[model samples]
Target chain A: MQKTFKIVDEDGIHARPATALVNTATKFKDTEVFAESGGKKVTLKSILGVLSLGLEPGDTLSLIAEGGQAAEALSALQEVMVKEGLGEVQE
Target chain B: MDKTALSKDILKLVGGEENIEQVTHCMTRLRFNLNDNKKADKAALQKTDGVMGVMINGGQFQVIIGNDVPVVYNELVKNMKGSPEGRVSSSSADAGDKKKKNVLSSILDFISGSFTPILPAITGAGMIKGIIALLVAAGWMGTTSSTYIILSAIGDGAFYFLPIILAVSAARKLGSNMYIAAAIGAAILHPTITTLLGAGEPVTFASLPVVAATYSSSVIPIIIAVWLASYVEKAVDKVTHASLKLIIVPTVTLLVIVPLTLIAVGPIGVIVGNGLTDGISWLFDNTGLFAGLLLGGTMSLLIITGMHYALIPIMIASIATLGYDYIIPIMMVANFAQAGATFGVFLKTKNSKLKPLALSTSVTALMGITEPAMYGVNMRFKKPFIGALIGGAVGGAFLSLFKVKAYVIGGLAGLSGIPMVIGATFVYSLIGFAIGIVVAAVATYIMGFEDEPEAAAAAVPAATADANASSSNSAVIADALEAETAPKVTEDIYSPITGEVKPLSEVNDPAFSEEIMGKGFAIQPSEGRVVSPVNGTVFSLSKSGHAIGLVSDNGAEMLIHIGIDTVKLKGLHFSPKVTAGTKVSVGDLLMEFDRVEIEKAGYSTITPVIITNIAEYSSIKPGGRSAVKEQELLYTVQA
Candidate 1:
C-alpha cells in the first residue's frame, strides 16, 4: 500500500518526529515500511536513514508498506505522523 | 599483527567489507557502523597487537588505535574495501549517537571550516594592501592616480565582497546550494537595497518593516543566512515534487530567507560586530597597558583554540570606522615574542634533532606565522611558552604606553608589516617588536627547560652506581679506571667504537633518519670493533651478526645496527662477541667486523645507536662532539 502525506509542521521530519516515526514502524512485524522524499527512498524504521532524507516543512512524504501486516503498518504510521504533528494524509 | 596487519585483520573479524555500512575516525578511534553486530569477534579484535582498545556504543563499533590510528585507517580504506581512488564514504550523521558534536567542537569546526578556504584569498589581498600602503607612503604612487585606483580596487575587492565569498564557501560547508546562498549575499549588497538603506528611508518588504543593516564587507551574517537556508531548502525539497523542486526550492528559500536575514541575521551580526569593536576600543582607551597585556599574553592561546578569528571582524570594523587599530600592533609583538622563545629553545636545547626545527620555526614566528614555532618549539617546552607570554605582555605594555597604531590591514604581524604602522607610531612599534623578542629570548634562556626525560632517567642509575662504587673501596675505583675511566654510575651511552659522533638525523636510512626507530646518535665507525654502549643484557642478536638489540637493567632499550642494509651481508665479514640473553657491560666487545671489507661490499659503515623505546621519554640529548674514544659519553636518554 502507498500513501502520500503532506508535512504540516513548521519543522518537518526532524529528530523528534523521526524518532517517533521509527518507533511506530518498529511496533509492527512482518511488514516493511519506507519513506520516499527528494527522489530518495529510506526505511522508515531507521532514524538515521529517515534523517538522511532531510525532510522539512511543506514537503511531501510517500509512505509505503509491504507484506502481511502492510495495511495495519501504513494506518499506524499515518496516525503517528498526524498525532506527532509531522504531516497530514492527502485525501 | 602489526598496525597494518591488525587493521587488515580487523576488517575480516568485523564481518568483512560487506558488513560495514559506514566507517569514520576521530582523533584516536576508528568508528564503524556494522550491518550485523553479532558477526564481529569483539574479543579477537581486542587482542590484536596494535589495537589499543575496543568499544561498542549506540550501534557502532569503535577500535581504538593510539597515534597511529590514521595510518591503520588509511590501510583499511585504501587496500581493503575502497575503490581505486581510495574514497571512503563518510556518513557521520547516520552513525547514530556516536557522532554527536558538542557546542565547543561545533563552533570550532564551524570557524575553522569557514575560514580555512578563504585564508589564501585574504592573505594575497592583504599582502597587496600592505604593498599599496607602502607605495603611497613612499610617494611612489598617488592614492588618486588611475593606476593606484585600479590596483587598490583589485586589492580591496576581496574585503569588500567578503560576504558574498563567505556565502559560497559557507553554503558548501553547511550542505546548501551555493548559488541560492550566494544570491542572498547578492541581495544584501544589491545597489537598490544599499541605496535605500544609505538614504535613511524607512523600508518595508511585504508590508513588514525592514531593519536597515549595511551587509557589505560582513562575515557572520552571511554564514548565518547560509546555515538557515540549508534547513529551508531541505524543508522545501521535502514538500515539492521532484519535477518542481529545481524552481520551488530556490524561490521559497529566497522569499523566506531574504526578509528573515534583513530583519534578523544582518541586524544581530551588526550589533555583535559593533559591540566587539566598541568594547575593545573602550578597553584600550581606559585600561591601557592592562588591556594590552591581557590581549598580547593570551593571543596565541586564542589562536590555539581558534577563538582568534572572532577578533578579525573587530579589526576590520575598527580600520573601517576609526582609521586605525591598536590590536594588530599588540598581536605583532605576541608573534615576535613566540619567535624569541623558539630562538631561546634553539640555543639551550641539547637535543640536536630539535635544533634545526627550532631555528626555522623561529624565523617564521618573527614573520607572524607562529604555528610552527608555537606547536613545534614553544609548546614542546612549557617554560619557553610561558616566557613568550611574559615577553609579549612586556612588549604590549610598552606599545600601549606609546599609543601605537596599525593604520592599514596587512598580511602578517611580521617585520614587513611595519609599512602599515605609518606616522609617529612606527618608531614605537619597532621598539615594541624588538623588546618583545629580546625579553622572550632572555626569559626563556634564564628559565631553562628539560627535553629528554629518558636521558635523565638513565643518569639516575649512573649516579647511584658512582656513589656505591666510591663508598665500596679503593679497589672499585681502580677497576673503574682500568675500564678506560668510564662513568660507572650513569645511564649515558658510551661510544662503542673510536669514531666521530653525529646526530641520528643525519643517518642515511629512514628507520634512523626520521628517528622512528628511536632518538639516538649515529657514528662513523673508524674502527672494526663494536662494543656494548650500555651496561645491559643482549635482548636479541640478529643471526647475521649485523644488528644487536640490548635492554638495560633500568629498562632502556637500545638498537644498534652496524651498517646500512648490512643484514644482506649474511655474516660474511661480521663476528658476534655476545649471544642473545648474555649480560654485557660498557666497553665490552659485542661484535667485530672488517670496516674496509664492508666498505668494499658497497655498504655505508655508519652505525645508528637508537633507543627503540623512545616514546617513553620526554627528550633524548644527542652527544654533540667531533670525535670520541671508546667508552666516551655518546648520548643521554632520560625518562
Candidate 2:
C-alpha cells in the first residue's frame, strides 16, 4: 500500500539527502519501501531513483510499503523524513 | 538528475522542440522569442532552480538567471543549434493575425523599441536640465552665466547631436554599417554648415539648389540619411574591398553621398516629418475620443513589441513647426496608466511573489518607463491590462479634452517631456497626469486580475475529485462508514446565477475534509448554489472569492470552499454574492458563484465543503451547496 505526503523542505532533498534516506532504509531485510515523488518512484537504495523523482521543494510524494519490515521500515523511513523535515508521514 | 541533465531539464522547461526564436543577453536576462506565450509553464519556471524570476516583456521571455545569466544563455543557445527565424506552430497561433498592421500599431512599436535602450541618457539629461533651470530661476546663475552655460551645454549636448544617435540606430535597424552612417549624419550637422546656413544663402550641391537648413538639433534628417546610407553601403560591399579599395572606396563614396544627401535626403526627410505631424494633428482633431480610446487601450501592446521608436520624427516636426506637440503628453499618461493598473493588482493580491514585480514596475512607470512592468506583470494576468486600457483611454481623452501640449522636443513621448508639457499646457497637463493615475488605480481595483488557473487546479491531485463524490451522494455511503445523525431539513436549492451545480464527490479529487482523505465530510451536490446551513457569521473569504470561511453562533467553524482549483479561475466564474460578517438563515442563499467554470478550470466541484470547526462540537452535520432545501443535514460531527 502507498500513501502520499507533501515535500516540505525549501530546497528539497537533493542527491545526498535522498541517498541518506535510501541507504538507511536498505538496512531492513525483505521489507521493500520506496518513495515516489512527482509521479516517479526510485528504488529504496538506488541514488538514481531518488534524483529521478525531480522532487521540487513543494512537490508531494507517495511512500509504498510491502514485505517483512514494511511497517517497521516505513516507520524508520518516516523518522528520516521527520529528521530531514520534509513530507508528512501518513498514519 | 545530474547537473548536466538538470540544466537540460531547465531548457526543456522553457519550451522544448522549436518554441524559442532568438536568444539575446542583456545585463542578466536571457531573452527568448516564443512562438506562443501561453504554451510555456510559467509557474514551473518560477520555482525552477537557477532561475531568479521570469519576465515577459516586448513579446520576449526574460529569465533572470542573475549574474550567471551569460552561462545559462550560452548553455541554452548551444543546445538550440541556432534558433532559426521560423514561425511558431500553427496549432498555437493567435486568431486573425494574417493582416499587416495598420500604420498606428506599427508606429507605436517602432517608438517603444527605439527609445527603451536610450532612456537612461534622456532621464539623466532631462534631470540635469530641470536642475539648471531651477538654479537659473532661483538667481544662483544667470541664463548666460558661465556656470549656467556649462550646465546647460551638458544638458543640451545630446539634443544638439541627436541626429548622430538617430542615424546609428536607424542604420542598425536597416542592418547596415553604423559608424559610416553616423559620419554622414555628422556631416549634415557640422557647425560650419550651420554658419553658412545662418547666412541665408541657397547653396548649390551638384547644381541642385540645396535647402541651407542647420541640421544641428535636428532628428528626422539622420533617419532619412542612414536609410539612404544603408543602400549605398550594401552596394559598396557587393562590389569589392579588394584592390586597396578600403580607404579609397569609402572616401569617394562620401564625396558622392554628401552632395546627394544634402539635395535629396534632407529635404525629403523634412517633408515626411511634416506630413507625420499633420497626420497626428488630423487624428486628434477629427476622431477625438475614438482615437484616445484606441491608442490608450493598445499602448502596452505597443511598448511590449519595442516599436514605440517610430514616433520620433513626428515629435521633432511638431516642435519645429508648432513650437509644441500634445501627443507626447498624452502618451506619458497612458504609460503611467499601465504601471498604475499593475500596481493596483500587486497591492491587492495575497501572493508574495507578485509584489516585487508590482513595486518595481510601479516605480519604473512613475518615471515614465513601463516595459519592465508591462512585460513583467500586467499582461501575464488578463484583467489588469484591461484596467490599464480603461485608465489609458480615460486619461488620453481627458488630455485631448484639455488640449495639453509640450513645447520642448526632449525624449519624445517620454516622461522627461513632462515639465515642458506642463509649461506649455499648464494646469491642464498636470490635471491630466493626475487623472491618468487615478483612473488607472481605480480601474485596476474594480477590474482586478486573474491568477494562473493551473496552480489552483493542480492544488489537489486527480483521484480525490471522484471518490469524494461517491461518499457524498449516498447517505448509506456515509452511514456505512461512520454514520452520525445529521440534522435533517429540506429547503430549496435555488440557482446562484441561474447556472449548473455539480456534486463534489462525483468530481475528480479524492481529498475533501471527510470523503476520501480527511475526517470531515464532502458533498457532491447537483449544482453550486450554497445556502446557509445555520445562522452564522461570515469569517474569512479570499479576495478572489473562490473559498469562504464561516463561523456558526455555537462556534462551528466551517470552510465553504467554492471549487477545486477554482483559485486558478481567478474570479472568472465566481462572484461573492455576500460580504464578510453577513448574517444568514438556514435557507437563506449565502453566496452565488460559478460551478461549471470550476470544472472547466481543470478542477472538480468535489468541494470538501468541510466543517473545519467540527472540533468545537461533540458531532457536526454536513450539508450540500446545491439540490437540497435549506436546513438539510449535509453532515455532522460529534464533540
Candidate 3:
C-alpha cells in the first residue's frame, strides 16, 4: 500500500516528526515502511535515513508499506503524519 | 588536552559525527563503532595529527591515541555528545559477535589493557630510577643521602605501589568502579597486612587461613583482583535496588571481595607470577647465551604483535622478588639495535623521504621509543631489520655471558635506561650498548638492503645495455657472450597519461618527431596528472619538471616528457614530485600538470615516453589503439 502526502508544516519532517514516524512504524511487526522524496527512498524506521531525505515544506512524499500488515502500517503512519501536522494526506 | 580541532578533524576523517555509532577509549586508543565503515577515510585518519595508528579490529574502527587517550577521548565524547560509560564491556560484547580470539591476541589484549593506563607513571618512575642510578654511579649522590632518599621514594614509589595503579586501570578495562577495585588493592598492601606478614604471625580471614604474600610491586595480583571485582560489582548492582545502590553496592562488594582476595586471588596470583619469573630464570640459567640471543632478537617482533606486554609480569616479579632481572638488560640491547638499524638506513637509503625519517626515528629510538624506527625504517627494509636482530643477539649474548643484570627497571626502550644496568659490573652494560649499536649499523651498511629492487634492476641493464653499447663500439665478442647467456625477452610499457595516443612523428615538435630524444609514442593527454607506467625506481627526474626517467625492475629504461617546448616555460604549468631515486609501481601518481596552462603557454601537451636504451631492443612497436587510458599497454619492446 502506498499514499502521497504534501508537507504542510513549515519545519518539514524534522527530528520530532521523524522520530514520531519511526516510533509509529516500529510498532508494527513484519512490515517494511519506507518514505521516498525527490526520487530517494529510505526506511521510515531509521531516523537518519528519513532526515537524509531533506524534505521541506510543499515537498511531496510517498509513504510505502509492504507485507501482510502493509495497509494497517501505512494507515497508522498516515494518521500520525496528519495528527502531528507534518503533512496532509492525499490518498 | 584542549584539542577541539583534532577531535573535530578525527570525526571528519571517520565519516563525520553521524556515522559514529559510539566512541569509547581504552588506554591508547579510541574505539569507534561506525554506521558505515565504507564512508571512513582511512588514509586521512592515519595522516591526521595525534592519531598514532588506525585499525579495524573485530568490527570496531580503532584509533590509537597513545598516552593522552583519556584527554582526547574526553574531547571526542564532548564533541559528539556521547557517553563514555560501559565502553569496554560493550565493545568486548561487540567483539564476541565474531570468532573467538586465538590464545595470542587474548593474552596481548589482557596485558595491554591492564598496563597501558599506568604507562605514564611507570615510564616516568623508570626514567627517574635510571637518572638516580647514573647519579649514584657518577659519585654525585650518596646512596643514603636525604636528596637521594627523597628521589628514590619518588622513583621507586610507582613500582612499589603498582597494585593500586594497576587496580585503577584494570578495573576500567574490566568494567568496574576503579575506587572499589583500588580499595581492594590497598587492603592487600595495608600496613596491618604488611606488619602481620613481617611479624611471621598466622592470620585468618573469617576463620579461613590468609595467604602471606607480599603485594608490593606486584603485577598479577591487582589485575586478578580487579578482574574479579568487576564480576562481584556487577552481581551487587544487579541485586541492589536503585534507592540503596550507592551505599549497598560498594559495601557488599568490599565485604565479599576483600576476604576472597586474601585467601584465593593473592595466593593464586603469587603462584602465577613466581612461575613466570622462575620459568624465565630457568631459561637464562640453563641456556645462558642462547637464551639471551633468542629473547633479544625476538623482542621487537613481540612488540609488533603486542605480546611484549606479557613479559612485564616476569620483569616486575624478578625485580621485586629477586632484586635484579637479566631481561631488562637484554631488552636494552634490543632497543639500541633498532636505533642502530635506523642510523644505518639513514646513511644507506637513497630515498629522499626515508632518509629524514630514518635520521629522526634513530634519535627517538636512542631515547627509548623504537616504534618510529621499527615501523618507519628498519622493518620497511628487511635486511636492516635482520642486521638489527643479529646485532641484538650478539650484544645480548655478551651481556648474558658476563652475567649482566639491571638493578632498576628503566624507561621505554631507549638509552635513558642505560644507567639502570648498574649491577656488579656496569662496564658490561657499556660494552653491550656499544657493540649492539656499532654491529647493527655496520651490518646494515654492509648488507645494503635499502633498495634491492633498484640493485636488481641495475644488474640486468648493466649487462644488456653495456653489451649493446660495447657491440656498437666494435666489441662484438663480449656482446655475443652476453647474448649467449641471456635470452631476448618482450616487456609491456603502459601509458602514463590518459589521452589520444599519437606516433612520435605526428607530434608537432621536430626534436621529438626527428627522434632526437630517442624513439617512443606521444599522447595528447586529457588528464593533468602523470603516473608511473612501470614498476621501478626513478633514476633521473629533470629539475625542469617536464621529464621523468625510470628504470623497471626488469631493466626497461623509459623517459616521460610532459609537453613539447614545455621545459622552456620554466615549470610554470607543472608541479612534480621529482625525488630522483623514488621507488614507484605501475599506476603510482608521479605528478600533476596544468594541461590548460601548458596549452595556453603556447606548448602542445602531447606527452611522450621513450625507451632511451632503444638499441638494446630488437624492435619497439605501438601496443594498441590511438586512444589510451592510464595503465593501458602503449608500447611493447622485444629484446
Candidate 4:
C-alpha cells in the first residue's frame, strides 16, 4: 500500500519529527516502507529520506509500505507525524 | 565605623573617572573600552570593587568577570556604558538603536549560521551511503537490484535532492524570496535536465556557461549559483515594472539561462566545479599531507568564523573524483574534540552559571555546529579554545599519517565519514579520532587550566593598560602592599556618603581582599546621597558622579565608585554628586545620588565603594559601610 502526503508544516522535515518517523519505521522488519517522488525512492526508516525530500509545505510525497503491515504502517506513520508534529498532513 | 574608613581607604587610588573611557566584562575579565584608553587607571579599576583583571583585545575592553561573565556582562554592558568623557558611549547602545548591523555582513552571517540546521540530513545520508557500500562489499545487495534501489535511495536521497536544501539556505542568506530560490532550485534540479544529461553525449543548449554543476548533491556550487541568481532577480526586479518584474525576470532568466546555461556556461561552470574539486586534490597531493593536517587542525577555527564553507566544494569534488578525501573525518574528530575540551571545562568549573552553558554549547559542537559553543563558552575561557587547537593539531597529524578518506560529499560534521574509510583505513580513522579526543582532553586537563574557572582574571592585568606617564595623573606612588607601614600623608580623604555605617568586617563576601576580613567596608547607603569619601582634592570627577578620584591629605590616591554596572544609567537622574577640586568635610554632602533609578536600570546596587590606593596603608581598619555612623572610627591608619 502506498499513500501520498504533502509536507505542510513550515519548517519542512527536521530534527525531532524526522527522527521520530525514521525510528518508528525501523521497528518493522516484516514490513518495508519508503518515501518517493519523481521515481526516486528512499528508505522510510532513514531520517535522511524524509529530511532530504526537503519537503516544504505543499510538496507532495508518496509513502510506500510493503507486506503485512501496510495499512497499519501508513496509519502508524500518520499517527507518528501527528504525535510528533511532522509532515503537517495525514499519510 | 569601617564604612567611612573604607570610604577613606578608597579615596587613595588611580585618581578616578577622569581616566577611564568604558568598563565592561566577560566571564573572568572586566573589559573596558576606554575613551582615552590611555587615561584608564587600569591599576585603579583592577583594585576597584570586585575586579579580577583587565584584558584588552581586538578593540574590545575586557574584564575577566570569571564564570560569572554572562551575569556580569549583562551588568557590565549595563554599567560600563559610563564614559567619564561623557561623549558618545556604548551605553548609548540602548535596546533598539544598537541593532545597527551591517546589512551585508549579517547576510553573510545568516548563510553561515544556517548550516547546522540541516547537518543531520547530510550525516544520516552519508552514513547510509557508507552502509550501502558495506552491503555491496558483502554481496548482500546486487548493485542493479531492487534492494539496492531502496538502500541507494536511502543513502543518496540527500545528495540527490540537495538543491532543495541549498535553495532554502540560500533564501535565508540572500534574504530574498525564499520560495523563489526554491523554485529556481527546482528548475536546476528538474528531472528532465537529469534525464537529458543521462542521454550521455555532451548536450549543448546554448553558450551562457549555464554551468550546471548538477545541483543535486553539490554544496557550494548551488549555493554560489543561487546567490548569483538572487542578485539577477533583484536587479531585474528593479528595472521591470513591479507586476511584470517577478513574472518576466524569472521567465527570461529561465528561458535565456536554460539554453545558454546548457552550452558554453553550463559546460564551463560544470568544468569549473570539477576543476575546483581537482584543484583541491592537487593541493592535497602536491602539498603533501601538510594541507590535510593544516585544514584538519584549523577547520574548526574556520568553522567558528564560518569561512569553512568556502572549502565545501573541494570536499564535494573529492567525493566526485576519487570518491574519497580525508578532511571530513578529520573535521569530525576536531568537532567532537572541541566539544570534549569544552566538556572538561564544564566538568571542572564549580560556577553555577557556567556549567550549563558549557554543557549545552558542547553538545551543539558535537552536533558539528561549533559557533555557539565557541562564542558562548570556549573562547571566553581562553584555554578551552586553545585546548581545541591542540586537539586539532594532534588529530590533523593523525589523519595525515593514517591517510584515511571520505567517500561522500557532505558537511564537515559528524561521524558519517567513518564508514567511508574503506579497506584498512577504517582502523586508522578510529585510531586517529580516539587520539584526537584523548589528546585534547589530556592536554586541556594537564595544561593546569582545568581548575581555574577564573583563569581570565589571572591573565587579565599582567600587561599594563597605559604607558603614558605624562597624560595620567601620576599621583599613585608605586609602593607595594605593606602590613605595618604608617599611613602616608596625603591631601586625599575619602568619605562614606550615606548616614548609616558600621565596621567593614560586618559586610561579608569572602573577606575584604584575600584574607583580610572586611578591611574594606560597606555602608547602608541612603538611596541617593553622595559624600566626599576623602579630604584630598578631587583629582578626577569628570561630571558624572558615577566615579570620583581624590588624593588624600596624606599621599594616598584613591577612587570611590558606586554601583555595579551602574555606569550604564548614564548620568540621567544622578547628580555629579561632586566636582574635581571640591573641598569637603567628613559630613558635608558632596553630591545627591539616586539608587532607585540606578537599580531601575538593571544594575547591581552592591557598589564596591573601595579605595584604589591600599598599598600605601600599613593597616586600614574596618569601618563598616553598613552600621557605622558618619565620621566615627572609620579608619585608624598608623602614621
Candidate 5:
C-alpha cells in the first residue's frame, strides 16, 4: 500500500517531523515502511534515513508499506504527516 | 567533548595551569610554553578524546585540536588563576632556553619571527601589483585610466606606508608598544619631514643636521628605527610612576626616539641599505652568471637556516632605489627547481602514501610556497635536493646571462609572476622559468633515490597495537582482529572542499565538538567552494545558506556546515548553487561563497563535514593527513 503526501511546513521534514514519521513507522512492527522522494527511497523507521531526504516545502513524498497491515500503516503515517502540519495527503 | 571539559582535561594532563608559562594557538594547534616540559604528560594527552596528536617542538608543547583551538584556548584562560590574562611573565622562564640558543640562531629567530606575521599583507599587495602590470601590458587597461590609477594606489599603498606596518610587527616581536613604534615610523614619513627633505636644502633638528634621504618605501630605516624605539620605550617605562605611566611613557618615548632617528639613526640606516644594494649590484654586474648560480644553488640552504628573511630588506631596498630587482628572479628559479624535483618524485615513487603528498606539495611550490616541497619531499630524498641545486644553478646562470630583471615585486615567484618582468628580456625570463622546471624534473628522475620500504608502512599499525596493549584495551584488540578477519562492509566519504582536513572534535561548536550531531571531519578551506561528496539528493539547506544536508544513494546521511556561526551573516557573501531536493552527483557544485569577504567580516571559514547517520556505522576513520583536495577520500565508514 502507498500514499503520496505534499510537504507544507516552512522548514520541511526537519528533525521533529522526521522523528514523528519514524515513530509512526515503528508502531507497525509487522510492516516494512519506506519514504520515497525524487526517486530516492529510505527506510521510514530510521530518523536519519528519513531526515536525509531533505524534503522541502511543496515537495511530494510517497510512503510505502509492505505487510498484512500495510494499508493501516500508511494511513497512520499519512494522519501524522497532516496532523503535524508537515504535509497534506494527496487526493 | 565540549570546550570546557576538553580544556579541563588538557590542563590536567599538562600538569595544570601552573605549568603553563605562556599559551598561543594557530589555526589547528594549541602551543604552550611550559615551565618544565617533563611535567606535561605527552602520552596521556595523545590519548585524550579531543586531541588528534601531541608534539613537542622548539621547547613548546603543541596540542593538535583541529579548528576549535581558539575556543579551547579561551576556556583554558578562564580556568587558570595565576594569570588572569592567561599569560605569565616569560622573562624568567625563557632564560634557560635563551642560554641554549647561539647568537646566530637567536638573531635568525628574531628576524623570521618579526617578518612572518605581516607576510600575508605584503603578498596580497604584491600580487595585485603583478596582476595590474599584466593587464596594462596586455593593453586591456590603459595606463592613464581612472581604474588604473585607483588600482595602482591600492597596490602601491602597502609599500609606500610599509614602515608603519613593519613597526607594528617588529614591536610585537620586541615586546614593545606597537602604537608608539608606529608613531615613530609616521614621524619620519610625515609630510613636513618629506617636504624638508625634498627642498634640496639642509635640514636641522634641535641644532643637529638631519639627513635629506627619503624614507618612503625604504625597509632597513624603519626596522632599525623600531628596534631603537623599543629600547627607548622600555627605558622610559622604568622611571615613570604607575599613576602617570599612561601619559608619560609614550610622550617621552616619541620625544626621544623621533629626533634621534631624524638626526642620526635614519641616515646610518640609509647608508647601510645603499651599501647592501651596491654590494648585490656589484656581484651581479661584475660576475653575473657565477653570482646567480651561487645564490640560486644555496637559496634552499638559506631558507632552512632562516637566513632568507635577512635578505628581504635588501630586496626591498633594491626595488625602492634601483627600480628593478635581480634577487627575485633568482629566487623564482630556485622555487621552480624545487617544485620540479618534487613532481619528479611524485612520478617515480612507488609508495602510494608518498605520491599524493609529493604531488600536492609540488603544486604549492609552483605557486611560490616551497616550504612543504622542500622539507616534505626534496630533503627527504637526498638526490632530489641535489637535482634542485643543479637545476637552479643552470636556470640562474641562463637568466643572469641575459640580465633579466623583475620590474615589480610580484608575490608569487612562479609562472603566474612572469608578468612581473617587463623589459626586452621578458621572453628570456619565461625561458629561464621553464628550464628550471624541465632540468630539475629530468635530473631527479634519472638520479633516483631509494624508495620507502613496505615495512615502514606496516609499522604504523603495529605502533597503534602496542599502544593499545600498554593500555590493556583487550576489547579494542578483539574488535581490530574481527575487523581484519570479518567480511567488512565499508563506504568511502570524499572531501567536499579543497583544504586542510582536521578532526571534528576541533570544531568550536559543542554540537560538533562533542559529536552530539554526528561524527565527522572539519576543513580549513583554501577557496570559497563546496561540492557534493556523493551521488546524492539534497536533503535540506538552512535558510541562511550556511549549511546543507545530503543523502547518498547508498543511505549515507551527511551535513556540511560552512564556517562557524556563519548563519549570523544573513546569507550575505553566500550563494546557494543548488536548492534542496535537487539531485547532485559527486563533484557537482553545491555552493559558492566569497571567502575573502566573509573572512574580512570576521568569520572563520573552517567547514565541518559530519555523517549524521553515524549510528548506522561501526567505525569512521579519517585520512591521516592535513592537506586534502576536493573529491579525495576523506573518511572510510565500516559497517
Candidate 6:
C-alpha cells in the first residue's frame, strides 16, 4: 500500500517527528514501511534513515508499506501523522 | 536503530561512563583511554548492534563503528559529557601509563601526538606542490606567471611556517601554553633573525654567540625550543602571581626561552639535524642499497613510534642543502608497500567487515594517509605488516640502485608524490613504486593472516535480525533482550545535588513521600548547583527548571525534582544548563538554583532524587553518605 502526503509541520520531519514516525511504523509486525522524498527513499522504521531524507515542509512524501498488514500499518501511520501534526493524507 | 540508544549500549558495555578516562575517534573507531581495561566487556561490545569489532592496542580500547562514527561519537559525547572531572585532562591519563613505556616509546608518543593533528596541513600543501609541479611540467603555467607564483607561494607557505605550526601542536601535546610556544617559534623565524642569518654575518645575543642557521622550514629547532619552553613556562608560572600570570608568565618565559633557543637549543638542534642528514647521506654514499633496505624495512616501525617525524627535518635539510632528498623516495616505497599489503588483505579476507575496511584503507594508503590502513588493517592482521616490510625492502634496494631521489618535498610517500621526483630518474622512481606495491601484495597473499572469525562479524546479521524481530519494540529493545538473556548487572546512581541526605518520607509532597512517583531518597541541598547523577541524555526538563529527568546508560530512568511545589516560581531563581536531549555525564553541571530565594518564596528545597522506573530494578541500596557531595554514590540499583 502506498499513499502520498504533503508535510504540514512547519519544521518538517526533523528529529522529533521522524522519531515518532519510526516508533509508529515499527509497531506493525512483518510490515516494512519506507518513506520516499526528493528521489531519496529510506526505511520509515529507522530514525537515521528517515532523517537522512531531509524532508521539509511542503515536500511531498510517499509512504510505502510492504507485507500482510501493509494497509492497516499505513492507516495507523496516517492517523499518527495527523495526531503528531506531521502531515495529512492527500484526498 | 537509534544512535542515542546505540551510544548508551556501547557506553554501558564499556563499563559505563565512569570507566572511561578519555575518548577520541579517528576515521572509523572510537578510541578510549579506559581507567580499568578489565572493566570493559569486550565480548559484549563485539556483539553490540552497531559496533563492528573491538580491539585493545596502543594503550587504547578501540571500538570500530565504520563511517557513521562522527554521529555516534557525538551521541557518545552527549551521553558522557566530559570525563568524570568535567575536564579533558589527557595528561593525567598519559602520566599513569608513562612509567610502563620505555623512553624511546614515550618520546615517539610525544612526537607522534604532536605531529598527528597537523598532518592535514602538511599533506594538503604537499599535494598543492605536486599539482604545481605537474602544471609546470606540462607547460600549462609558467614559473614567472602570477598564477604560478601565487600557487607556489600557497604550497610553500606551510613549509615556510613549519616551525610555528609544530610549536602549537607540540605545545598542546606537552600541555603548555600554545601561544607562548608560537611566540618562541615566531621569534626565531622573525624577518630580522632570518635576514641576519641570510647575511652570513655573526650575530650575538647578550655576548652569547648565536648560530646563523636557517630557522624557516626547520622542524627540530622549534620542537626542541617548545619542549624546553614547556618546562621554562612552568617554572616561570610557579613564581608568578595568579593575577599577573596572563601577562608575566608568557613574557618571562619568552624572554628566557627565545635567547636560550637562539644561542643554545637552536644551534644544538641544527647540529643534530645536520648530523642526521650527513649520516644518512654518508650511508647512501657508502652502503648504497643496504641503507635503503634498512630504512625502508624499518619505516613502518619508525612511523608507529613517530621516529618518522625526526626524519622529516633531515629530509627538508637535505633538500635545502644537498639539492635532493634520498629519504622521501625510500619512504614512498614503504607507503606503497603498505597499500599493496592492504589490497592483498582486501582480496583474501572473507570477513565482510574486514573486506570493505581493507579495500577503503588501501585506497586511502595509496593517497598517503596510511594510519588507517596501518593500524586498522595491516597491523591487525600481523602478516600484512611484515609483507609490506619485505616489499618495502626490495623496492628500496631497486630505487637505491637507480639513484632515484625526490627533487622537492611533495605529498606524503604515495602515488600523489610522483611529481616530486620529476627529474631525470622520475621513470625509475615510478617503476620502483610499482614494484613495491606488487611485491608487497604478492608477499601478503603468500603469507595469509588469521582472518576475523564468523562469530566476530556483528553488524550485518544483527541489522537483519533486528528488522525481522517483533515490531512492538521500544527504543532499547536490543538492550531489553540482552538484559533478559544476560546476567543481572548492578549500576550505581550518584547524588546530583550536594547536600544533607534525607529520607523520602521527610518530603512535604505526598507524591514523593508516599513513593507514588518511585522509591528513592531526598537531599536537603546546601549548594545551589545541580549536576547529572549518571552518564545519559537529559530525558526531560520541566519549563520551570524545578524537575529534570535522566535516563542512565543502563536504562535506569531518574527524576530529580528541586524543592516542594517550586514550579509555581515559573523558572525564577532557577537556571538550567542543559535542555531536553542534552547528553550529560556525572558531575556535569545541569542546573543552578537559589536556595535562599526558594525558601523566602515559601518553598521547602528538599530535592527528591527518585528512580522513576524502580520496578525494573530488583534492589536499591543507599550509599550511606549523609553529608553528601555531588557525584557521591547515593543509591545502587541492581537490575
Which candidate's DockQ is highest? Answer: 5
lDDT of candidate 1 over B1-639, digit per residue (tens): 466677779888887876675565543457666655545765456556666445443334667664566678888887565531212335442233323444654565455445555655665666677678779988999988999999988877877787888887777555578899889999999988888878888888888888888877777788888899989999999999999999999999999998999988888987787777788888888887888888888887775554675676567667655657889898889889999999999898886556776888799678665655775568756888899998899998888878888877645677666766775588988998899899999999999997744343243345343322222222221112122222222368888888866656567876567554556788899998988888888866665677777878777777777888776677789998888778999989999999999999999889888776553443444453456678887876644
lDDT of 2 by residue, B379-490 (tens): 6465777788788888888777767776654542445546667454678777777777778878888877765343332432365432322222222211221212224322
Candidate that beats the other on TM-score, 1 or 5, i.e. the better one? 5
DockQ of 2: 0.01
Model 1 lDDT, full chain set = 0.72
Per-candidate Cα lDDT values, in order, are 0.72, 0.58, 0.73, 0.54, 0.75, 0.75
What does the lDDT read for residue B184 in candidate 6?
Answer: 91
* Estimated TM-score for each candidate: 0.52, 0.47, 0.57, 0.47, 0.53, 0.52
Which tens-of-lDDT digit does each residue in A1-91 have in candidate 3?
A: 8999999877666534665787677656579999999998888865445655666789999999998789988888889989989999875
Q: Report per-prediction Cα RMSD to one decimal.
A: 20.9, 20.9, 17.0, 26.6, 24.0, 23.2
3 or 4: which has the higher TM-score? 3
Off by over 4 Å in 2: A1-91, B1-117, B172-175, B275-298, B304-307, B312-325, B339-384, B401-430, B441-639
Task: Between candidates 4 and 5, name the one with more favorable TM-score.
Answer: 5
Compared with the true structure, model 6 gives a TM-score of 0.52
Candidate that beats the other on DockQ, 2 or 3, i.e. the better one: 3
C-alpha DockQ of every model: 0.01, 0.01, 0.02, 0.01, 0.07, 0.01
Say which docking band candidate 3 falls in. Answer: incorrect
lDDT of 5 by residue, B518-635 (tens): 6678999998889998888987776668788888888888888898878667679899999878999989999999999988999988888887666455446545435678898777
Off by over 4 Å in 5: A1-91, B1-95, B131-150, B321-323, B346-364, B367-369, B407-427, B451-639
Error of 5 at B423 (Å): 7.8
| Native contacts retained, all candidates in order | 0.00, 0.00, 0.00, 0.00, 0.18, 0.00
- Over 4 Å off, model 6: A1-91, B1-99, B281-287, B301-325, B335-387, B405-426, B441-639
Interface RMSD for each of the candidates: 25.2, 20.2, 26.9, 28.3, 13.1, 14.8
